[model samples]
Target: MSAGASGVGGAISAHGLGGAKDLPIPSELAIAGAVAALVVSFTVLAVAWREPRYDAATSGRPAPAWLDRLVSSRALAVTARVLGMAFFLYVAAAAVFGQDSLINPFLGTFYVLLWVGIVPASLLLGPVFKAVSPARTISMAFAKVSGVPEGQGLYAYPARLGYWPAAAGLFAFVWLELVYPYSTDVGPVRLWCAAYLGIMFIGSALWGTTFLERADPFEVYSSLVAKLSIWGRRDGVLVLRSPLANLDTVVPRPGLVAVVGVLFGSTAFDSFRESTPWLQLVQSLSGSRVWPDTLALIAFSAGVALVLTIATMATGVTSDTPRRALPDLFAHSVVPIIVGYIVAHYLTYFVEYGQQTLIQLSDPFSRGDNYLGTADLQVDYWLSSHPTFLAVTKVLAVALGHVVGVVAAHDRAIKLLPPRHQLTGQLPLLAAMVCFTVGGLYLLFAA
Candidate 1:
C-alpha cells in the first residue's frame, strides 16, 4: 500500500531496485540479540569508568603534519566542492531531462547513494556533505560578491533555533520518502529537491553557513555521524579520537532528540510498513494510504522522542544541569542506533542499487550512451543470493549499535548525575535502550 512497495508484487518498490528479501531471522537469534543488549547495558553501567573519560577540549591527538596539510589544503577543499557540484548537476540533468521510467538514475542516486550512502562515506571521511555541499559553495560565492565576510550573515543565527530546523527538514524528507505515494515519480522527487535547494540558499543568505550547519538535513546528519569517525578537530587542528571519545564531543542543542527520532523512527517505519500485518491492514482499509502512513510516521517519530525524553529526564540531576537538558545531552548515544538501523535496512539497497545508479549515470538521458563506462558494468547480487549472511549481518549491526549507545549513555550519565543517583539514574534509560534494541531486532527479523 505504501509507495515503497506495490500492494501485491510488482516492479515498483521502496527503493528503485527490489528482489528476493532475506527470510525472517530465526526467533532464537532475535532473542539472543535482545539479551545481549541487556548484558552489555548493565556491564557498561557496572564496570565502565566511573569518572568521565571524554573531554572535547583535551581529547584526541593531532594528526601527522603531512596528513593534516592534505586534509586542510585549499586545493583539496576546492576539488571536493567541484566534485560534489559536478555530481549534483549530473543527477539534476537526469531528473530534469530524462525519461520518467523506473530505470532513471535520479531516484537511486537520491534515495540510495545520497541518503543511504552518506553514512558509510561520513564514517570514513568526516562530514563529507559539509565539505562538498554545493549550497555552501554557492553561499560562499554570494557572500564574497556581496562583500560579506565568511561565516557571517546579516544577523547572527538564533542560538535558540539550534538544530530544530534541521530536524524539521529531516522529517520533511522522510515523510516524502516513506509516506508520499508519488515519491517514485521523478517530478515530485525533483520538486522536493528543488525546494530543499531553495531553502538552503535562502536560509544561508539570512543566517549564513551556521544556518546550513544546523538547518540542512543532510549536513546535520552527515556531521553527526562524522562524530563517530576517528577524524576530529581540536583548536582548529585535525586530530583523531576514539569513536566513543569523539561521540562525547557532540554539542547538546535544542531538537537533537527529534533529529535522532526522525532518523531512527523513519527507518523503523520503513520496516514496519513493509511487514505483512501492516500491509494487510492497509489493504483492508482501502483508501489512500497517505493519511494512514503519515499518521504512523508521526507516531513513530514522536514515540521515539517521547521515550528518549522520559528515559533521560527520569533520572535525578545536579543543580549544574537541569534534568530537562539530559535528552539532548544524551542524544548522541542513539546516533549509533540510527547508524545501525540504516545498515540493517538499507545495506542491500545501497550496495546493489548504488552500482545500478553508476551504470545509469553513464546513460543519463536513457539514450544508451554508456558515457562513464558504467552501463556495461554488472551489479553483483551476491548479498541478495546469500540470505543467511545478510540476516546475521543485520542482527549484528543492530546489537553493536545498541551496545555503543548504551556505553555512550552510561558515560554521559556518570559525568552528569550526582554520585548517589549515578547508577540508579541510568536504569530507566538502560531499559528504554533495551526496548529499542529488541523492537528493532524484531522488526528486522519479521520484515
Candidate 2:
C-alpha cells in the first residue's frame, strides 16, 4: 500500500503508518494462492465431515490442576493490571511531553505496537488485550474502591448492543490511521486516545467489564483472533483445543457480523486507499481528500457487512433457526480469512516497525535518553529485504486461512441447515468466501 505522507517534520510517509510498501507480490504467487483457495473451498465442501464436530460442552479436556491454578491466580491478575497501568502511564508521559515528531515513541507505539502487534499477540495468546487493557484495569480499580463487585454494572448489559460499539471504535481507529490527514501528529492522536479512554471508563461504569468485552475494539478483535489459538476454557478450566474447535466456541451475539465486517473491510480499505489510481483520483480533487477517504472507508466496511449478511442468510434454514439470525451465527467462519489477509497486508510493516518502535521506546521524549537500554539496537529489515520470500509467505498464509474458514463454515452448515438443504445452502457462502480470498490476493498483487 502506498499513500502520501502524513506525519510532522517529514518523519512518516503518505502511506499512513507503514514506512515503505513491500514490492507488490509477484503475479505468479498471487495466482497460485487464488488457485489454492479455490481447490480448498471445493475440497472441504466435498470430503469434510457432514456432522458438526465441535461442542463447547464436550470438545476439550481440562488442563492439569496446577496449570489451571497458576493461570487463574489472583497474583497473576494483579500483576497484569499493574503492568498495563504502568505502560499506559509511560506512553501518556511521552504523548504529553515528548516532541511532536517521528522521533516521538508515542507515534510508533500507537501505530505499530498497538495497531499491528495486537494481531500476533492475540494469535499466540488468547485475549491478550483483555488481560492487559488499561481501561479495564482502571475500571476494575474504581469498582473496588467504590465497594462495587467486579463485573456488576448499574444495569445489565444490553445483549442487543453486542459488538456494535467495538465495530464503531475499530472503524474510527482505521479512519484515524488511514483517512485522517494529520494522523501522525502528536496532538490529534493524543486527543483521540484521551477520548477513547474517557468513553471506555464511562461505558464500563454503566455496563461493567461487559462493556469492555463488547465495546473495546482491540479487545473484541483480539478475542476474535484468539479463538483460532489452541488455548480455550471449559467449565472454568483452561484447555487446549484445535483451532477449529476453539473457533466453534465463539458464541455469536448481536453485531458479530458488523465486527467481522469492520475488521476485514478496514484491512482491505487500507490496501485500496494506497493504490495509485485511488491516490491520483483523490489527490486531483481541489478540496480536501477527507470526504472521499471517509466515504471509501464507510463503503468498504458496509459493503463487507452487506455481502456477508446476504451470503449467510441466502441459505434455507430449519424451523428452529431463523434465516435472519444466520449472519451472526456464521460470522465466526470469516475470522480466519480476516486474520490471513491482515497477515498478508501487514506482515512486513509489523515486523519492521514493531522493532523500530521498541528502539524508539527507549528514547520516548526524543532527548536520546536510553531508559530501556534499547537505544543502540538496529531494526533488522530482513523481511522487507527478501521480497520474494515475504510474498510466498503471504500467499501461503492467505491460502491456509481460506482452507480453515471453508472447513469451519462447512461444519456449521451441517449443524444449522436442514439435512436436505445443507450442501446447497453452503454454495452461496462458499462463493462469498472465494470472492473475499481472491480479492485479497489481487490487492496483494496489484497494490
Model 2 TM-score on a 0 to 1 scale: 0.95
Q: Which pairs clash (backbone N, Cα, C closer than 3 Å) in model 2? A: 3-14, 4-14, 5-13, 5-14
Q: Rate the local accuracy (lDDT) of all candidates.
A: 0.84, 0.82
- Candidate 1 has its poorest 10 consecutive residues by lDDT at 4-13
lDDT of 2 by residue, 1-447 (tens): 322123334433333223224444556657665767666666656675777898888997787888889889999988988998899899999999999877788887887788778888988988889999999998998999999999887988899999999999998888888778887688999999999999999999999999999999989989999999988999888998999999999999999998899888988888777678888998797468789989998998898899989999998898899989999999999999898887877777677666777888898888879999999998787876676677677888788887888888888889999988888888898888878877777766666
TM-score of candidate 1 on Cα atoms, chains taken together: 0.95
Candidate number with greatest lDDT: 1
lDDT of 1 by residue, 1-447 (tens): 235323112423343223225744575667575667667667756776688888999999999999999999999999999998898898899999999866788877887788888999999998999998888998998999999898788778999999999999999999988889888788998899999989999999888999999999999999999999999999999999999899999999998999999999988888787778987888888777888788889999999999999999998899999988889999999999899888878777777767777788899999979889888988887877787788778777788888888889888888899998888899888888888987887776666
392 Cα displacement, candidate 1 (Å): 0.9
- lDDT for model 2 comes to 0.82
lDDT of 1: 0.84
**TM-score against truth, every candidate:** 0.95, 0.95
